[model samples]
Target: MTSKVHLPYFDHLLELLKDQNQTAIAAFGRHVHWGYWEDPSSADGSIPDFANAAEQLSRRVCDAAKITDGLKILDCGCGFGGTIASLNERFSNLEMVGVNIDERQLERARSQVHPLNQNSISFVCADACNLPFEDNSFDVVLAVECIFHFPSRETFFKEARRVLKPGGYLAICDFVPLKFSLPFTHLIGKFLTTSVHNTYGTIKSNFSLSTYRQLAQKTGFITRIEEDITRNTLPTYPLVRKLFRENGAAETEKITAGAELVSKLGITRYLILSFEAIDP
Candidate 1:
């Protein structure tokens, strides 16, 4: 039988891509968009008013965990610091730190975020599984839509437990693998449609809720909340297709192919899991 994965840090590779693509705008990876809500909810199937939707998602998360003012927060795998910026506003006294593997994203985060706020928010180039911080360093650790990329779920959970205080919480909102090795086209669609990429490997190892919960539990985190954001993201298909079409057929085909792959692979869901770290 095969053993569970335990990923190693690549010290040399880290320095090479440290400051590659720092943009002058916000951190949406591809675009400078703030919220991940380019939806089509109206009669003409126009994009949904996701500003409210995005805010609600962020607010719900903060409210659920009692994330208040003046807490030291860590955003693991924070892409472009969008979540960090949003949460910082929600909590006026929040000391926010965003860590991303992509140097380009961190650069853009540094440039776009306010200079005064810079003191409050620090963006660093670091790996999620291997964080550079003392134990019990944060009050709350938020991994919004960015943890699956970690080479090992076990390593991530261990690190999360290490850095968080005894009662500190870990909230993750990202894609969960339902099964291992999804169709390549579905994997490709996920990237093209969402403007996100897979730096780790193929779309295989996409896990289910139970898979994630088990890993979290194994790492000593007590699962507190788990919700599916799949339906919310799923219904936006028409709008995504339309946008792809406007971009042209070749692009649309690639996007649709990815979409179909997700459907065929019985992988049509996204997840958000929240847990509290147990002190030994």
Candidate 2:
């Protein structure tokens, strides 16, 4: 098991699930990331609403990957197999593999998500930066709101490119820092290192949009879609913070509040990016 990754948030979530916390299970049983709302104001801030919004976010990323019937897809950093389950329910005759570094998460994913709609679903315990697969193995690769926890974006890009078939899409959603706000965000991150570590565990949100393009060019991929949906995802913070507070994760709630502040101020933008694998 590749247990090198440290995610205190997941640990907390797992404990909550063990205790049969219905609200926690409803909000994060499947998806462990932020939610997305088409109309930010329409967000009801309820558990069911947040779960639906989270599903929408997964669909948005899958659409960006151009997934279709009978395609083989690899979802890296898959948390509890939420995206995979969504794909299974929507598409047919698809081969989907959900990979996560944490065995605990993978176990939950395997136990919860089953193949449906003529789709095949499997979970693998592996690091995103070091994929355990052959070259040209998948038609589409996805990383949904979990790239920040990766050891190295460049390495993960290379790995994704290696495993993807020719012209395959690599779609990911990440928290990208605005170019001008890099220094300020870095300074703040340094100051809140302990708090952030205790909450999210090993997040690297300092990467900029321009750097993503450059990385794609260097990793034999072409930028296909670069959309900033920060506003669409803003509704997630309040609900998540409320849940964290109710769950007695005060530090986590505080850290999440800080993230919400930066995102609202446009210092940190949530971006959905898709790149096509090209000939090397």
Candidate 3:
């Protein structure tokens, strides 16, 4: 199946994995997102350390969603089923479905993740903004570090609300710009367009926290959690850059460095946000 999105980073990772690159498999075989360290200073910058931190990041989002046993869940943009695997391990009797537009990633996910601890798992290739599930079918919907790649956040939010049962939760992590940074971000985005597209594909990182709240309200949801964990995610940049460099992706490394700079300057914030579906 043809994917609507074009993420070059994933293409590189898949190639490396196919070639039996052990470090690449170890670092990104599961989760393809940034890591979260409880204490940034204590991050040891090893493959194992980064992998553990990545798992922690997924758990943090799940915790925000108030995930419990026996709840039907949908993980949108579920790259390689990492979060689904994590959830399958921690919870029992869960009806879990992972949705991604890219079938290649879903193929790997299907091969790697299986039902465990009485949890059922399935991976579907579908757009985040156009889920194939029935309305009000899921108790929780998660989008971990992938909202920026969606065609439209507003549409995805509306779809998420539609798919969730009443009082169900939607949890996501994203790079949110501060209100004051929007103008500057737009200006910089124009110049970085080609480079960013070549490295990470289309990304929309100009959404501010206030805009998120407005989106939640407009989409029949109430904002529940908006925690900024940018500091904790800082340790991910160095490790990711090193990996990119080792893999001979100079353009990707340069783009990642730029992202790390903006993040360190507080121009962009990494946030975990959860919203509860409400009756309209």
User: Model 1, stretches more than 4 Å misplaced?
Assistant: 1-55, 61-64, 115-119, 177-205, 244-257, 260-266
* lDDT for each residue of candidate 2 in 1-280, tens digit (9 for 90 to 100): 3356778888889899989999989999999888889999999989999999999999999999999999999999999999999998999999999999899888889999999888988898889999999999999999999999999999999999999999999999999999999999999999999998988999998899999999999999999999899999999999999998988999999999999999999999999999999988
Which candidate gets the maximum lDDT versus the true structure? 3
Q: What is the per-residue lDDT of model 1 for residues 50-70, given as tens digits with 9 covering 90 to 100? A: 334445555555554558777
Question: Measured by TM-score, how close is model 3 to the native structure?
Answer: 0.99
What are the per-residue Cα lDDT tens digits for candidate 3 across 1-280?
A: 4456899998888889989999998999999999999999999999999999999999999999999999999999999999999999999999999999999999999999999999999999999999998999999999999999999999999999999999999999999999999999999999999999999999999899999999999999999999999999999999999999988999999989988999999999999999999997
lDDT of 3: 0.95
Give the runs in model 3 whose Cα sits over 4 Å from its true position.
none
* Ranking of models by TM-score: 3, 2, 1
- Model 3 / residue 210 / CA error / Å: 0.2
